[model samples]
Target: MRRFASRGGIDTERGAPMSKTEDESGTNAQERGDGSSQSSVAAGRAFGKAVLRDARRGAALGAGALQRGGRLLWSRLAAKTTKSERRASPARSPAPRGPESGAPASPPFGRRRLRRLMGAALLSLPVIIALSAAMAHILLPNLEEMGARAEDRQVFEDAHGAPLIIRGAVPSAYAPLDTFPRHLVDAVIAIEDRRFFQHGGIDIEAIARALLRNIRSGGIAEGGSTLTQQLVKISYLAPERSLSRKLHEAILTRQLERRDSKEQILEAYLNSVYLGSGATGVPAAARIYFDSAPEDVTLAQSAALAAMIQAPSVVNPLADLEALRARGALVLDAMEAQGRIDADEAGQARDEMAALVPRPPAIRYGTWFSDWITRSAETLAPAPRGVSLLRTTLEPDLQVAAERIIEQHLAAAGSGAQAALVALRPDGAVAAMVGGRDYGESQFNRAVDALRQPGSTFKTIVYLAALAEGFEPGDRILDRQLDIDGYTPVNFDGRYRGEVTMLDAFAASLNAATVNMAMTVGLDRIAQTARTLGIDTELRQTPALALGASEIPLIEMTEAYGAIATGRIPFEAFGIRSASGMAGQDRIALNPVPGASGPQIDRIMAARQDMATLLRRVIDDGTGRRAALTQPAAGKTGTTQESRDALFIGWSGDLITGVWIGNDDNTPMDGVTGGGLPAQIWSEFMIVGLNLADATTVGGAKSLETTPAPAQCNVTACRRAYRSFDVSDCTFQPYSGPRKLCTR
Candidate 1:
């Protein structure tokens, strides 16, 4: 039997086994007290061990999950580390622990290190996302008022309300989306952006594809811009290639997509895209290329227009027909592939492209005049947006006549010679203008831009100044050779009259006599007189200036002559009569204000009458004798040295016309004088113009009969006999029968 002695009220077992009876008794005793306490202690130890094992497993799993998430975030946020970087790094090994040390083995990633890294990653994610969101928000663009950016039509009309030229955006050329044919829309989409409808503003798949292709090509040869992106760029961003710009474009694109529908976006894009040859939109391109409306355009024409999108100046039909045809074939093939058009349709489109002939150029009557008026209108009344109607003082018939006359006269002059003609009404309104022989040959507006020596035309200014200083038409001056300083001016014919009246010297265009008059009046006063008459060109105060050595624009000289014809100095020559737009009608002051005092007005009137008398003498029997008309006429002939410039400026009735003929290179013409070619052209034009005016009079022949004639004059019979004579200037014929007659 095993015996247990109790010490301090505890039972102790010395031997391994006890008797059956003793075992039974011990078991019962243990079950009652100490056995229960030992069991509870063992259970507590087991539970603590389970909890410890679970905590260790959880920590390992959490570390692995956090590491994976951090790696994914890094891959998304930054460029991936290359394989070369991995190869360059050395391999790490686990450190061996000493037997005496009690620390457990460290994980491949240290627990503390893992905790710090994961904690940082967890904390940075929200900040990074917030920053990205803020940046995207900041880069968003304003999409309000999309139509405001579109160009509006500008229509320029002549005095008769006839459209001289349509400039800027053509109203008829602007077509809405519904007006566009389905084939046109499909063609544009197939060539520009195939996934326009399917993608969000930023097409991720397209971007990836473009990226891969660019990488293989070793250059940025492809762009993944969707239609929305292109619209955003055209509307807001400049055409620049940069990551920052692309980012901004992408952000704006998304905003645009969210704000507008696909149809709206496509419409704006089609209407705003620039095509070649001054066409700005699909409708304009269609009209310019095909001479057809938007909806009437054939599929092949639509394809050609779409092809122009890549490089308008290079691929347009008018610029490069072969390139346009080739590109249009590609567009057709794309449309066929996308199932927008059948293969047979594509073939037909190809045939149409081969047969395509661009519309012949339209006959533009007053291009130079329209361009000048447009520029002036922009400066005077700028239309930010919407249609602008510019009513000008131009007469369509007169413009046509002027153009024809210039072409006819310049043909005989020579191939290298060019001509410019400007005609103004007595009130300083521009009636007709021809900047060059052909505007298509050169866009340089010689009438308003070219500064050439006015020759004797500027003598009018000197004489005008003399008259303002109380010199009369009969005021006599020596017309012999004269030298002032180092400048010596001689007459055009090299023969001078010893002494002559001011009117005779002027009509003969005696340079020496004109210079003497300029000297008497002072060059400064002459310059001031030129300014008062609307000659803005700089005039040298030399003696040569008196003989028209100063260079001046044809328009300015014409305007000065206009002032004399109207008896008004300091008046502006204006082409635009009225300009109305979305902003409002511009209050254009066409006529000069009556600001001159009584005495000043009287002086100007007297000078004007004297100048008129002098000019009439030149036309009647002097240098401009060839320019005389049956009715009262006045003018001056100007021939520069070596005949480099020849001009005839004259007035018949209420029309003031200035004609300039010269070589563009400033070379001399063979025996071409102002009295020869320019005067002939001027006479022919004036004859047609005055006849047309008379024929179109409100009451016809009856209107002429109403004019008050001398008491002995038979107005009707005299007009019938002399169709060209004004009733007031006619006299009764001596042998008058029952049917009274009159003569000039």
Candidate 2:
């Protein structure tokens, strides 16, 4: 012991020996009358010398090891060399003593020494892996502290910008970790990471077990990722399976563990982890699987959902019931093994979870409208990267009203029927559109997709052509059976009104009179008029076209009438208000400037004022009498043959609404006419819910009557002018104006 102390440079009788430099500095301090400072300085100097001596000895040992490693490496390289290369080694060549040979090479390590060195290297491998893992964690970026953020969730809203729903990779609502039942958290931790709280981000024991299992299975059947590693994998690293990604995930996991507590990590993981079926987080998963809130999730349901964390698609409760129950059993076993639940409790929980099955999520109303906005938004810009806002023209009140009316009407009518209602401003901004009775039942937007014939409602187009062709409002025509080219046309009542004025014929929807006018003015002219009004689809030029035989979409028909309601350029229907994100910025203009070139609706209505009068009379006393409001409401009613389709499209003030009701299979309703059910529904929607007072008449007032064409030479006023014409052959009277034919 005395010899060992002396070698360590400490005196046995006293303490550590004073160094020469400390002895000199202490004498100088004593000379300045600071004896206490001298002794402290002497002790510090001796301790530093001892530390330096130990460091020098460590350096010598490290150098010796390095030399040994070099010899072994050179010997291995020489062993691998070819015979010709081996001849160049010093062992195979003659010694050279010339000064040009810079220095002598160390001899290669003997085979025994090489084996010893290899044994030392093998023994140090585990230590090397441990140190490397520690260094990797230390060098990792401070991601948890740096505050990285995921993309903001996009929100779908009502037309007026009220938030309706949120969509993304998942919909999430963060909650405190304690809010979940203990079994719920235990189930996740048990199956995913048995040693979650004990491990420092990565568990070597778990990894070893996983590797062994994978090797035995001859495939990657197990994943050893701890909870922290999974969090780092999904949040920070790319989802690709590669060495670099795994390295990055491991590094970020350690960094995450250092900065956040176990509870915080659990909260974040439970909030954003993808549990399957578009359930991004635990809250969304609970709601989607149970139709209940997160806090209300039952233990059995929670275990089933937790089992999905390992292989969500493979263990989908809805798709593979047996597989899901098996996974639930495994989770229960793990929980019991971890002492989180007693064996009896685990058995009872397993039995309960075995009976659990998937429940379809309850869909909220108005997703059709949201989907419509999504489709329209895709056209306006690229898909949203972050939150996107779609400003729509939908009125919640009117939408609710329309939905209620369809359900009531369908039940009362006692038929399996479908109805669509679309209401818009004169400028074409859609206000309310109930495309079907229940959007949850069907997403097919019938308002934009259905094409039905507008029976007498199309007569407006035929008569507009007649008014422009010099026929006055009083040009009487016979509403009797008429035949042309072997096709006879009759009135809806199948009875003849000998001769009725144009206004009376239109009010009663006298088919023969309307057909007579169509033949006289030409079918081509009527089609052109309908197209100009707003009907974009093809129109037939046959006489049947005059009787509303052409198939046109309901929206197109409503917009065509909208043109006549207000002369302004139609507002192209749009729902998206604005789109913005990390991608870029885009916005939609609310009111676009009207074009100056087209035939204006107000102008055309003003020119054909007599047509407006006829429509008003129809609503007042004719087929559309049921649609009359407190004010002068002008609209046309249309019912197809056998009442196959019923339509009531009209305008009050600048607001135009069109309603269509029929079976999807085109089965005729029991005596349902356009003027009966459709008109009443239109009245209910417009007056009861839409709340538009008759602010202005559909068209203001009647214009001056035009001079009748000279083809009508039956009246006494034109008898002298038509000297060679037979008055008895004419069916209508002539006009009393300065006739261009009379001038001859």
Specify the highest-TM-score model's number.
Answer: 1
* Per-residue lDDT of candidate 1, residues 1-744 (tens digit): 222243333122311122234333455434568776466445544553454344434433555767787776565434333443455535652344555466665533334555577888677555544443333333223344333453355556677755455442232234568889999999999988988888877888888988999999999977887888877877777788743455567666776787778997897788778888877778677767776778989999999999999899899877899988998999999999999999889999999989877983354577788778877776754443555666688787888888987787677666468889888765567878888877777877888899999999898888988888888898899887877777788777789888899988988888888887788889987886786666778888888888788899998898788667765544456787665652355534443222222233345546887888899999888999889898888889999999999999988766778999998999999888988999988998888777775323311112211222212334555566664534543433334432211221
| C-alpha lDDT of all candidate models, in order | 0.72, 0.66
Q: Return the lDDT, model 2, position 146.
A: 32
Q: Judged by lDDT against the true structure, how good is candidate 2?
A: 0.66
TM-score of model 1 vs. true structure:
0.65
Cα-based TM-score, every candidate = 0.65, 0.55
Clashing pairs in 1: none
Clash totals for all models, in order? 0, 2
Give stretches of model 2 more than 4 Å off: 1-155, 164-363, 381-386, 468-474, 569-571, 580-587, 590-593, 598-605, 608-610, 692-744
Worst 10 residues of 1 by lDDT: 698-707
